[model samples]
Target: MPKYIVEGGFNFYEELYKSLDDELVDTPIPDDTQNSTNDFNNVCLISNLPLTDKFVTLECKHKFNYMPLYNDLVNHKKKYNTMERKTLKCTEIRCPYCRNIQNKLLPYYDDIEISKVHGVNHISETTLIMNQFDNVSCKSYIAGTCSHEYMCSDGTTMPCTNSMVTLLCNKYYCANHKYFGKMAILKEIKIKEKLELHAKILEAKKKILEEKKKTKLAAKMVKDLAKEEAKKVKACAKAAKVTTHAENIENVIISTQSGCVQLLTTGKNKGKSCSCAKIYQNNLCLRHHNLINKNKPYDGTGTNYGNPEQAGLWVQWVNGQEPEPDTDPDPEPK
Candidate 1:
């Protein structure tokens, strides 16, 4: 005999809804007794079995209460005949209690199959059963529920409910956690902006200082240049004054030498003119010369005149009288 098994933990109503066809007409079951067929052998077998709430049945006339037996059959398809053996002639399924094969005939009758298999009357039970499989939680946020809020692509704030759910952690988060995360991001952005602004300000200040230094250096250079130029002008002026004084002295020397009447005269005033022929050591006539030298003491008592003729002329000139004619002097003995 073929062993009958039924998987209980997995929600059959959800699977039934998932396997349904979209384009199908809603057909209601007839309440007429003649239209219903009953398999007496299957019904007798099911009734004779032990009465237990743990018993579950599949559409293939398989029954199982233990989860291991159902799991072994569903998981190990190569070792289990339920999935691998096509020659068993049990490809079609029928309702265990009602003996109805309407789902097999028309695959679109999923709602009716769900009701007959799981005893579910409404679609809400299917939703509740499916919700049990969703065991995901948000990993991005710590110690809070998901608020489903996020920043949109257009730089605006929007609700995260309609957004695509992330498969990594199911996009679950609390409102407080999401709010704090957003605030942290905004704070980081603000700090970065402030640092950039501070850097720009420092760069501007550095540039200004550099410009001031350049200006100061240029001013100093100009001042130094001006000072050098002034020194050059003063030096040129001094040199020109010295040259003019030297030229004036040179002209005076030339004029005195060319215009003098007594060029043979000696002493400090040698280039001057004189009226008398008898000149003294000074560049003057004997009378003026004797008047200036009269205060000197005489060394000898006799006359010291080497030339008596000039001496006589000097004596007469000093006496303010004309000179007499020349006369012979006494000879000296050896």
Candidate 2:
């Protein structure tokens, strides 16, 4: 039996074990839904604080305070380098909210001061002057509040704080103080505007349909023209049977009696005598004659026309110019 060796003393091994146990107890395993919470009030997921100098992850779109996220990334890299086996290794630089791998983050500037300065009172100077000329308050005196006062449906005048302005009448009134007659008028105006938009959309759709139909009709016409052209080309090819090299040879040999005695050079009939009756001027078939003479006729030009007198089978019949008249002795014997 071998005894396990412990350095320092017996207490050293115990102390090391205690430290390891403490580390295991203190560090909790990372959960995928650790940051999944309903606290989305413009707060950082890592520090749980209002996001300042916010940096949003490109992949997750999760907003975070710049310093906290940077620190987390650094810590994660350190842990990974130290051989810490843990899920959601920060070295990969994951988004704290969704745990998605993040390579870059974009700055989202949402300055409260700038927003307040540019809120309601940021109307144009000309519009301000026009409001002053009309003896009406600019309607937007402060941020998040309306300055317009109007009579309610109850015939009582009240101050409105809503920032909404009706597109039809340009009236500024809160929900509580909105007049019924004005509401009906706004509804009618909205309905009419919707109807007009729907009509325009329908007209656009109708135009698109007409364009599609015209395109299909044009395509059909082109296809019909192509078919007609193909039929004409086919008829011409049939009429001109000697257009190809082989067809020209067949045309020349149609009136011949015997074929050429040239041997085949290739294919299954290689080394065999050619049976083609289309003899050329050299007493060989057109193909064999071309090969021997090294003559390349353009698209079988010289193959169709040849000297018919050079045919080996052609023999002139030599008969006397006049035939003898039938004898009277032959008629008597009949």
Candidate 3:
């Protein structure tokens, strides 16, 4: 692979994809395709999506500082793996073998982010680019050891591939996206993409569940409440009807259960009690009629009937029939 000395502190990747200027010509690429403006511009405008998820391989360094890198990869992984926001700080370490300037490489961020792309963060466009450029690796994984004999994926390797911190990208300044500075950018792009994918799947699942639960629970509760309310309304109506038709009502209703229902006159029968005394007019009980017969029953100051028991005539409220009188001849016109 050709070496590309990366310069930092700006949108170098964007600029590189924009145009391979003559000044940074030494930065290695597969071949100059400046003639293709469209392709160049597209690459320059790298999608904020992850392309691939592969380890960045490199030549080994005799001595290295692992803490800072480890922390960076860890933080980046959160932003990349989940909805967590990641913080990327540039490193000032140089290439061990080539003596080239190494930009900030957050090992911690890369450490956690590079392992995943299966469930949520599956296809990282930038990760793909980085993997293509350099041999990417992880402390928890090993390449060329996919043999069933070693189970590095499960972290249960008999002859474990757990070496000098699962280091990949041993050499820097490589052509393509895995270049020292470019590797970080590519990783970032992948991180965002993966995080998005994970988040999308989670959100979709959550929404579907929420909708289903709401629909089922709300429907059931509403139905139950409606039934209870209907029962209450029916009871209230029955009570109001009883109150309105209390005294004048008769055994008009025949209930299903033979349950005692205070029956009322359902028919259209309008009348007063037949056993009244004052307006008797022959409709009076025996007492008042007898008094009239005697001609002296009320002759004095007070009104009196012939018999005493006539006052106890049960004043039953019966249906009124149109009155029919004997020898009654009506020939009046108003």
Tens digit per residue, CA lDDT, model 2, 1-334: 5576876557666689999999999999887454555456478877888776444544666777766765565555434454545443212356657767744423324553332111121333333333333343445333343435677899997766576533214444433333442545556757987999999999999999999999999999999999999999998997776467677687676545367666665556667567675666655675556445432222333343343321211122122223233232211100
Query: Model 1: residues >4 Å from true position, as ranges?
Result: 1-173, 256-334
Candidate 1 lDDT over residue span 128-203, tens digit each: 2233223334543344334455677889886544332322223334533443444544566579879999999999
TM-score of 1: 0.29
Task: Work out the TM-score per prediction.
Answer: 0.29, 0.25, 0.26
lDDT of 3 by residue, 1-334 (tens): 6555776646566677768575568786665566554443333112322223422222333222333333334444345555434322233333433444434442323445355431122344565455544554433343332111234677875532322322234423212222444556566777998999999999999999999999999999999999999999999998998877773354333212232121222233223222232333344444335434432323332245434332222111122332222233321111
Top candidate on TM-score is: 1
For model 1 the local lDDT of residue 247 reads: 97
> What is the C-alpha local distance difference test score of each model?
0.47, 0.54, 0.43
Off by over 4 Å in 2: 1-178, 242-334
Give the range where candidate 3 is weakest over 10 consecutive residues by summed lDDT. Answer: 310-319
lDDT of 3: 0.43
